[model samples]
Target: MEDRKLTVRSVERALDILLCFTRNDDLGLTEIAVQIGLHKSTVHRLLSTLEERGFVIRDAATEKYRLGMKIWELSTHLSRSDDPAILLLPAMERVRDHLGETVSLYLREGKERLRIQAVQSNQAIRRVAQVGARLPLYVGASSKVLVAFASTEEQEALLNDPEWPSWIDRVSYMEQLYEIRECGYAMSFEEREPGAAAISVPIANCHGVVTAALSVSGPVNRLSIDTLYEYAPYLMEAAHDMGLMIQ
Candidate 1:
């Protein structure tokens, strides 16, 4: 019984070490030890074991640790199995076909939003969304929609984060978030990539919790702000359908 308890405790500590990477992309041995309240020796042992399993990786030059490909592999598996991204592909495809642009589904991952699913446009000149892409949560329309509909505590945390670009107008951005909450959607022009434009709507689950952002994106020439507005109703309809699939 004592051996079993010790094994469980070790497992719990290892999980704590993995969770620490969610906040920061990388950490040194001592930083991880300090964060998890473990001695450096204990942390080192656990990290070595994790590294051996490809659950974590160490940077030889920086001597820092970050999550490894195995985590992504496991997540990919999870995303494939009854996940919202998989379930919402048809809706995304319909929106893409209707708008003649790329349609994508984004989910928040800590300080970033991840493109989990996408259907590309047939246009020769169009924006392309890569699945498994991560973008900051402060720029694009999908990012804004995800952050705008998040919990109040999360909003405050993001608003106060020091890593935001100096060019951002905080006051106006806050107001935009408020408008997004009121208007039910968001739009961005060249915020992340020049000549790129997108409009996004929040996708809420059956319990009214916003879980994802449904977006249509294309070249600025074809998807101006006005054009994006015209496409909003279709995006909203698809988002509503996706929401129903969540529960």
Candidate 2:
């Protein structure tokens, strides 16, 4: 009974401390203790242990604590889950051949999306995103489709958070999301990078839940909006085929 009580309290306190960081911009031990109703000495001990484990770090100048790199390391590992990638590659290859554009696969890691695999087009010019790059889910066509299709609670949870650094205009993201749902694919023209364009379709499993997105991208000169629009049908078809394989 004593051990059970300690375990419950320990979990409650740890969750409280993590939640406390969301309320303030940056927090010191005293601030955390006051907010979480823990003693300052206890807060200090927990913070030091978290820091040693690389889950939190101290600011040199301000002496405040914030999230640490260990989170990113873990995120990278989780983003590259192999089963989806293996199933998606053949369809990506088919779409690459049909559109003659660079094709990519993306999956969500927390609130961010990571590019897990890509195949470059054999064109004279190409636009490239590295395999392991992380991008905000609120931006870019592919990421937005993934976000838009998520449960309303999950969507609001991300949008309502006060800690998001790069603020995406909420209205525009909503508009783009509507378009993605209507068209069964997402399209963007150099929104993230000027002079480039992208078209993406979300791939779903047998249950019709989106598991990943496949996108094709290239430079404006070669990949005009008209060309992208023409490719959208093919992109959706490829995604459907890939989803069947993955499911």
Candidate 3:
């Protein structure tokens, strides 16, 4: 009766055991088996494997099981540039309210960039970015930040890609990356879309790797250097908070 084509039973049962502990701080072997409608022996076997891998930890005194730091470690890496919309959407909404501009979360894909998340301004007319919108990594505030923090090999390959001419010469590009690294952000003014401007800050993981970018964008008149600089701290703070949530 099981749908073997679409599901793997052992993995499903293991996940079930994991989910049981979510509602209860810790669960005994019998309780987990009861919760998942599985036999005690089966649940114990699954927990043995999980505990061995550090996915779950068993209390020495009580023998009850709880999620482990391994879960946190895996979750940290799982918070990719495009995923974790639940955390990113609300954070970006806060940024939009503070800056009165559209806030976007961008991720890199090969030589291109994608706006995976966004919160648009309430104004009748404001800069807007549809989720999953693609842009060139060589332009735009978010794109530049993603590129500036990209892995060296990725940066090299993108810089040399022939689909588009280099945005800047290698010497200047390197210098710009250094500047962005020092400043902890990047900005663009009417560089991509006419009359639009944006500023972006990097979101780094606990490992200090830049994984995503948070950007505020609007009409050039409103998103000026002064305004963007003013919101830079808030943007950076939001990015940091979001990063911590991943860990």
Most lDDT-accurate candidate: 1
lDDT of 2 by residue, 1-247 (tens): 9999987987778768776654355788788899989898888888887789887889989999887788668766764344777667776788788788899999877888888889888887788767867787766778878887778888878887775544577777678777778888887788888988888889888778888888889888877778888888878887888887665
Local distance difference test, each candidate: 0.90, 0.80, 0.84
lDDT of 1 by residue, 9-104 (tens): 999999999989755889999999999999999999999999999999999999999999999898766755458878988878878777899999
Q: After superposing candidate 2 on the true structure, give the runs of residues whose Cα lies further than 4 Å from its correct spot.
A: 1-82, 165-167
Q: Please report the candidate that would top TM-score against the real structure.
A: 1
Task: Candidate 2: give the clashing pairs.
Answer: none
Better of 1 and 2 by TM-score: 1
Off by over 4 Å in 3: 1-82
RMSD of 2: 7.1
User: lDDT at 127 for candidate 1?
Assistant: 82
Q: Where does candidate 1 stray beyond 4 Å?
A: 1-81
**How does candidate 1 score on lDDT?**
0.90
TM-score of 2: 0.66
> C-alpha displacement of 243 in model 1, angstroms?
0.2
State in Å the error of residue 108, model 3.
0.6
lDDT, candidate 2, at 52: 94
Residue-level lDDT tens digits of model 3 in 1-247: 4677435888899999987864577889989988999999988988999999999999989989999999989877874654646567877888788778898887787777777788999988799778767787877888889988988988888777787575478888778888998899999999899999999999997778788898888998787799888888888888999887653
**RMSD to native, candidate 3:** 13.9
